[model samples]
Target chain A: MKKNPQTAACLLIGDELLSGRTRDANANTLAKALYAKGIELIEVRIVPDEHKTIGNALIDLKVKADIVITSGGIGPTHDDITADAVSAALGRKTVEHDGAMKILKAHYAAKDEEVTDARRRMARMPKDAELIANSVSGAPGFRVENVYVLAGVPAIFDAMLEEVLAAVPDGEPETVYHVTGEAKESDLADGLRDLETALKGLKIGSYPGPTGKGGPLTIVCRSRSASVCEQAALAVKALFTAQGKEAEIGQGDRPA
Target chain B: MKKNPQTAACLLIGDELLSGRTRDANANTLAKALYAKGIELIEVRIVPDEHKTIGNALIDLKVKADIVITSGGIGPTHDDITADAVSAALGRKTVEHDGAMKILKAHYAAKDEEVTDARRRMARMPKDAELIANSVSGAPGFRVENVYVLAGVPAIFDAMLEEVLAAVPDGEPETVYHVTGEAKESDLADGLRDLETALKGLKIGSYPGPTGKGGPLTIVCRSRSASVCEQAALAVKALFTAQGKEAEIGQGDRPA
Candidate 1:
């Protein structure tokens, strides 16, 4: 039976990432989390912190995927224009969220610090949006429609993601099986092609190690149906066997 | 004087990436190299190994960027469909290039192995493409029009990029200046907005560190003209000074 898998797209907004100053850790974290919940991360777009770019990208991605998650540009800085961008994209007015304001005010007051205007900026969100609790930092992330706006800092982004993921419904989890062999990718390409043609709704992947890594090739079979994935895995092993090679299951090939 | 900066985009192809199995290293490497060569990396798209999806994404990115670079899916495997996708996107026929075949043959011959059909698959390229020398591996990458096809292996990708970058012309190098202060992004947000309005053709960025990393905030000014960037940096320092906060120039703010 075919399963209609929910799809997700990531919009990583940061000029630091494009400038090669900061390596992205959020995409991989989100991709893995979404995968465990059976949500397919179909595409990831890394764009700068410009207002027009962020707004346009959000609109485009929202139309294509079931949900869109954006990271960065949510800090208390002049460059933190994600709230304004989301408002523009969704055609809503930016307003101070009551829940967000209360949380920020309480956190700052408890610490005996005055809540500055820049600190208050974090409380603003698109009208009619729900707040996504930020446990790591006082500033909460707000969700407008299908888009979730989170903090750019890695710690806060990851923490806010936990809350976001809990609120979304889970889809069919994908079953993945792996087989490793001493054969090269070229040796099994044709057979793998035929096997893929024979099987429906299954994906077969071949990864070869670099030279001096001892000619190790891994074939991975993935599908929503466990039986189909298992059968495809057997066929892959048979192909290697026919070529006078041994395909070992669970041989600990490097992930991806 | 405002200078039109050349921009580039990267299309990272692989299901492994979407599956959250492999963290991407090529985009950062490529982004840094492009920045050094004065080509701004405006966007990065990570997609799965599907042919139609890859083809459609390629066409879209090619139009928006002056140059496009794709990494991964050049291996001798069924899942390595990047060449076919490129062919479909550009409407070019896939053909075996003589130059690539010779390199594969010589590399295999030295190891006393026959050049197998699957191995020969690496030699195939879009018609009228120039061969990119793969010094690390025998399988060569190729260039068609403005797109450069590169291997997914980090070693091979880095080596092939050296050749690819050498072939492309460099643009005006962007001059960047930094000012770091104890002030918060909120403390400087208003001044930054004013400064951005006064200066044309310059980008101002504010980056704040996470909690316990202290209340350090960095302001970056970037422009093609060194004098403009310097003047903007001084103005930023003056803003911090007017707020009774010391803004130090070249205090080793992390390069973005």
Candidate 2:
């Protein structure tokens, strides 16, 4: 929003999702979180748990985006190869993280379950990686270079990211103003076009629906500067009022 | 489900999506549609209208993925440059498709709007492209080589894809069977492990969820073959019932 803002990309990994067995909810959640933090979400890619595919996508995103976050493929089963794939992509070796293992062992011991060799696989991390504390589950996430490797499961991933996002520097996220009134897009097209041309950096979009004196048109005006957003919203209101349209301008947030 | 199935990739082009100003409903819809048609959705990428980024992603996807479907950046607006970027990626010249131009001109004439020079931009297509008729909107889509380009808006894109998908040959898509019962993944861990080891081609994963039968797990059996899927589902059903757990079988559909 200020100058040369940092950008992030997301890589969703898993065969179950590709097969349509699982409807992923994390991508949208992470997108919303990053947007609120002012980090530009440049791209989102969903790939199967294949080494070559994941490795290639990671390398590609690394060259373009400032930060990359990956979710899924970190389980005890054979298909969970996120750690291994991350290591291969970064040209590093996979090693056991003692701290992660300690946490996992404690979790299993509390539940009175034997920590078998298969379960220990969850403790493995890429070389020179920092562990992200998982509050929902004992299996910790890891960060190598600018790539943050996280689990696939929703609950655990959300908890881990809550802590991870706290460490990221905040950028200046754009504020939004909304005005929903009964007006056809065609009726407001000229004014919207003129407003868009004048706004420059500010974005003015009209979503149209319904038909009547007050046609349903949801106008969103967004900008990095709060004053700019307010000014644009006021100008839009004035134009709509002049056209004998009813419109209310307010901050774009949940009504509740 | 067949061996070495044809791969498909999606290129979502729009600045609103990258800036977190819009939620992408097209990717999931396209993925589900492609799956039903037996086209393996290999990768999905969200790229801005920037020429270099779109060109690079298009080149990479075209080489790796057999079919590439792109949405957005084909409208009349100045920001719409998907056609130009795609042609650049393929090292081809941008040219106007006569048939598309005629249809667009007719549509504008019917609406009584002047077909300005800016509106004519929508008629431009890359050389050697085939038009994919749009049912909802008059702005036709284009297909060049293995790349299928559609509008970024959901309604128009969906209608255009439905028409285009009918022309493409259907490959074998993966199928699935769901077996849920009063069971525990840990309890079935060793047995499921043996089954996974025995079935080389079939994929069996256990999803732990709230069991209505006072149990702790819901195992999902998936395979490329319906027979294999049925066999896996039966085995799980028999094993769970024998273990004094209530189990039921269900079916699922997945893209190849």
Candidate 3:
């Protein structure tokens, strides 16, 4: 039976991200979270804090993937247009959600301060949207349809992602087995291609050394079935062993 | 006269990226390079190493932006489908470029190795493709029309980016001035909203404290014109002065 895996797309909204003022750590976090949850993060897009840009990208991703998660542009500022854009994209009215209002009011009330119009903007969401709790901050992320809007800051995004991921169902997680060897990527390519064609469903990746010295290749084998991954990895290791090259097996072999 | 700035988009390709096995640094590098070159990075997309997905996203981005740059999946491996996908997307036939083959041969020849079929795959590019020199690696990146393909590795990507960026003309760089103060984002919202409307084209961003403490807000003002940015920054700093809160002027206030 061909099992259809759940797929997700991330729409990261902010001008700073596009302008290189901010380096985004949210995509990796979301990708790892979704991977652990067995949801395929098929695509990720970083757009500016523009209304039409966010709305267009959100609408596109929501239609393409089962779940669409957005980060950034939801803060309390004129550039915080995610709430409005999301509302328009999902065909819902933007309103001051009572639950959000209550949370913000209490969060500010704790410090003996009143919720300002700017802070209250965090409470604005699509009508009938469900709130995703932010343990780090009082400003709650909201869910409209299949799209989840979360805070842009890494700390807040990470905290809110845990809550939103709770609703996601688990599946057969992809198994990745990396085999590092002191061999040229080209030397292993022929063997890898032969096995890659025979393996059918496994993905084989060959990455060269970081310094581009042509040695210290890392072969990554991935499959939904752990057995297939093991088989592919062993075959890759054997290729190295055959060439009298030292090889070691590990879980992940990606550069930081 | 309203200046229409040159815009670029990035398409990061690799299955490891989507699987959360690798954290991407290419987007930020590309963003910063484009920013310094006075070009606007309008959007960035990270897609898995799939032919159709890469092709579709490439076609879309190449049409929308003045330039489209792709990183990763052009290695000598079964999963390296970037070159073929880009070729198909640009309606060109994939062929072994003489220049790429020459480079690959000389690179391997220096190491006392012959260019194998797997190694030769790196030389495949769209017919009539222009080469982007990778100073660190033997495999040269290719350009098909407005699209520039580069290596996924940071050192190589950074090096190749410098070469690609050279061909792009300088534009009116966006001006960004940040004022950080110990004030609630909500408290400043009313005043900010007033100036935001009056400033017309300036983009104002309010970032709460990293710890979500509700105080210590950072107000970011941006415009294509530096004078407008100065005017907005002065007004924002004045707001902090009026509230007797210490505000510091800086260049960037984004979280890493």
Badly placed stretches (over 4 Å) of model 1 are A1-5, A210-215, A238-247, A251-256, B1-5, B210-215, B237-248, B251-256
Residue A118's lDDT within candidate 1 is: 80
Clashing pairs in 1: none
DockQ of each: 0.56, 0.28, 0.67
Point out the higher-scoring one by lDDT: 2 or 3.
3
In model 2, chain B matches the true chain B with a TM-score of 0.87
lDDT of 2 by residue, B1-256 (tens): 1233378888888766665556777778887787776778888888876899899989988887888889888866546688999899898999988988898889779888666665677789899899999766587999988899998778888888898788887878767777787664445555666776777578777665311112355566766777877888888777787778888787763112
TM-score of 3: 0.95
Compute each candidate's TM-score over C-alphas: 0.92, 0.83, 0.95
Q: Report the CA-based lDDT of candidate 3 relative to the real structure.
A: 0.85
lDDT of candidate 3 at residue A238, scale 0 to 100: 97
**Cα distance off (Å), candidate 3, residue B63:** 1.1
Highest-scoring model, TM-score = 3
lDDT of 1 at B156: 89
lDDT of 3 by residue, B119-218 (tens): 8999999999999998887789988888889999888998899998786668877788899878767667778878989987788877776566455678
- Give model 1's TM-score versus the native structure: 0.92
Q: Give the residue spans of candidate 3 off by over 4 A.
A: A1-5, A251-256, B1-5, B214-216, B251-256
Using DockQ as the measure, the top candidate is: 3
